[model samples]
Target: MKSLLFHRLALSKDKKGVLELSEQGQEIQKADDILKDPYVLEFLNIPESYQFLESELEEKLISNLQHFLLELGKGFTFEKRQYRISISGKHFFVDLVFYHRILKCFVLIDLKGGEVTHQDVGQMNLYLNYFKKEVNTEGDNEPIGIVLGAAKDHVLVEYATESISNQLFISKYQLYLPDKKQLENELNKLLDDEHDNSASR
Candidate 1:
């Protein structure tokens, strides 16, 4: 009886080890597949997608707000939309503004309906500058800016920041959520035969 119990214990250990190794193998395969994906590779270098502006974002604002946050990448929270800021006897409105707890800085966003221009970038920078000067607390970091538009010229964006010292970002906004076809394709690619077999059991 003692020998039988020891044998059973050894078998259980071996089974657990095999299960762990299998899980590790699956993870590695998934990582490799993600790396080979064209969209994933492109996003790894630049997480923001440029193809989003074709959708009617402003018209569907309330309906697509959650999807919009997901597409904005990580560490972004929706604070307020159409935020009001008053300065110099004029009222200025920022389209969207978020406070990043980790960065401890206010993120100012401006929504544009067409191709992003130098003027747009300059205006965003000005907003950041103003917030940093007026609203930033002693513990807060410098404010950041994101110019969300229909399209952005990378070179022009860089040129627009030639003199600005604040951390500025440019991203395109999409009105619609990812289509069913693309979502299905990604799901199919992510799910493998092994996953199906496991589910069958």
Candidate 2:
């Protein structure tokens, strides 16, 4: 939650690169205000070696809905799994759907078993467009689409999302907790750098 707040509050970049709370952040108006990157799904308790299909993963999440909801942050209420949407005569399914009371928008999530691809992002964009055009009510805001993959190439995702207008984001999910020692070392290094700066001053 702390990490989410840090990034959430800094939605827009000024000319000088200074960070401040965005208009949306102040009102919790956008999905980015509440979404977290690299969502830690340590509670899923799936073995690292286990190779599970996307459907299997969805089942696990449904089974652990309470913990999953907590990890998803506040104001998320589960609406459905495999929520079907029809486009023309064809059909598509979103892995998970939720409603954010604060944002007043539908949250669409697509789970990927491995690295996220451009196609995955494109598909999510389609879902968002569908929801915005077909699903949103008079008072509802635009829907948010999240592509949650096991791995993502930062540069790839960055480029893929360029020029898109809808509220779309791609995030990674990990089954295990992060390395504590690595975190401690990074924190220590930051503290040491601060001390050095103070001494020089």
Q: Rate the local accuracy (lDDT) of all candidates.
A: 0.58, 0.81
Q: Global CA lDDT of candidate 2, please? A: 0.81
In model 2, the Cα lDDT at residue 201 comes to 100
Q: Stretches of candidate 2 above 4 Å error?
A: 1-27, 192-201
- Local lDDT at 178 for model 2: 46
Off by over 4 Å in 1: 1-56, 174-201
Candidate 1, residue 10: Cα displacement in angstroms equals 48
* Candidate 1, lDDT over the whole model: 0.58
For 1-201, candidate 1 gives per-residue lDDT tens digits of 311222222223244543554356323221111111011111122224443332334434535666555444345577877777788888887888877655666778777767889988887877887898888889978877877775678799788888888777776643333456765654564456448868999
lDDT of 2 by residue, 1-201 (tens): 433433322222331222343322333555776666668787889999999999999999999999999878778999999989999999999999999988888999999999999999999999999999898999999999999999999899999999899989988888875466755665566568669979999
The residue pairs that clash in candidate 2, if any, are none
**Residue 25 lDDT, candidate 1, scale 0-100:** 35
